[model samples]
Target: MSWTDGPFMGFDTETTGVNTATDRIVTAACVEWRNGQTRERTWLADPGIPIPKQAQDVHGISTEYAKENGRPLDEVVIEVAKVLETCAHAQVPVVIYNACFDLPLLNNHLVRLGQPTLGERVDFLPVIDPLVLDRALDRYRKGKRTLGALADFYQVRGEDNLHDALVDVRQTIAVLRAICTAYPQLGEMDLRQLQEYQRGQHRQWAEHFNQFLLSKGRSADVNEEWLV
Candidate 1:
């Protein structure tokens, strides 16, 4: 069977800010799809820091509310890591919209909490990132490539509740399935080949984008790593 037909897990995070290295996770969700069934798990964390107004505006999780209603940050991070590790051990692909940002951020959180990092726990392989796949497959598609835009472009359901971790995870899975339908070649690839393809594609795109930035007299800041 195609890897696309096998068990896969979708992951997403809503954070306190855009600085993945420093920002804390305010919310996270994982949706596991297998054998035509789906199981979802979600977390809301205190983050142990103030959730900036701008970030709260995007996700509607205010600092005050999170402090009152959320679980401990360490507990949330540990549980999320365990879930991802479980999927990794089971050889399930984790479908993340942008693996680069979320995975590193979660790893940072694990370090901060004095826990084993994801790489140490399990081989961080066979990750399926719809964002990288779409950019590589479509190449020159104009306009925004945000999750909401992809949902609209792919005609996936559940576009209304974006920025919520669980909703975004669901939308990401739908977008990935839509992408596979549009590009059957992806379904033909084994998980390792697909992951390597994305690594190369993301590197090429980053180099091109960096060159564009340098041409426009801006700093070339795009990361070339697929899952850093």
Candidate 2:
């Protein structure tokens, strides 16, 4: 069956900040979407560090709350990696809103915990990123493309309570499904073809964005890969 037929794993993370390399994960979610139903698992990690006020405000996960209710970072990291790897090897396309951020963040945490990264467990697994796909498909659509915005624009049926990992993942899956329903061309390609296509598409956008930055007299260095 095609990946869109359902059983896609939608993954998302809420971290301390935008620096995936240094920021710690405060919460993570993996939601399996199949035929309009969902099976989800979530992780909340204490991170063993301060959660910036800005990050806490966005996700509503305060440092004190995390410390009180969350699990050890090492334990959560290992479990999340295990679930993601299982999904990948099971051929469930990992659906993400902005994969470039979340996947790398997960990997960085895994490394810090001395655990295998997701790639170490699964090889070239299929990834479906709605952010990359939307940019490639609707390059001229002028507006924010955040999870909440996309959820609204796509008319996805769900509460778009972004910043919370589980809510974001569920909404991300909804937007993806809506995209498939609206654009048959996207659904025509199999999972591997879709992944390969996004690689090129993401490079094109990165180059364009780089030029835009340079035009503003800023550094134009940006990773051009879609998948981390």
Question: For every candidate structure, what is the RMSD over all alpha carbons to the true structure, in angstroms?
Answer: 1.1, 1.3
Query: Mind giving the per-residue lDDT tens digits that candidate 2 earns over 1-228?
Result: 566787899999888899988999899999988887889899999989999999988999999999999999989888888887887778888998889998898898888878778888878678899888888889999999888888889888474556789999888888888888777788789888998899999999999999999999999989886765
Worst 10 residues of 2 by lDDT: 155-164
Model 1 agreement with the true structure over 179-226: per-residue lDDT tens digits: 998999888888888878999999999999999999999999999888
Once model 2 is optimally superposed onto the true structure by TM-score, how far is the C-alpha of residue 83 displaced, in angstroms?
A: 0.7
Q: How much is the lDDT of residue 51 in candidate 1?
A: 93
User: Model 2 segments beyond 4 Å from truth?
Assistant: none
Error of 2 at 174 (Å): 0.6
Q: Residue 172, candidate 2: how far off, in angstroms?
A: 0.2
TM-scores of the candidates in the order shown: 0.97, 0.96
| Candidate 1: segments with Cα more than 4 A from true spot | none
Q: Cα miss at 199, model 2 (Å)?
A: 0.8
Which one wins on lDDT?
1
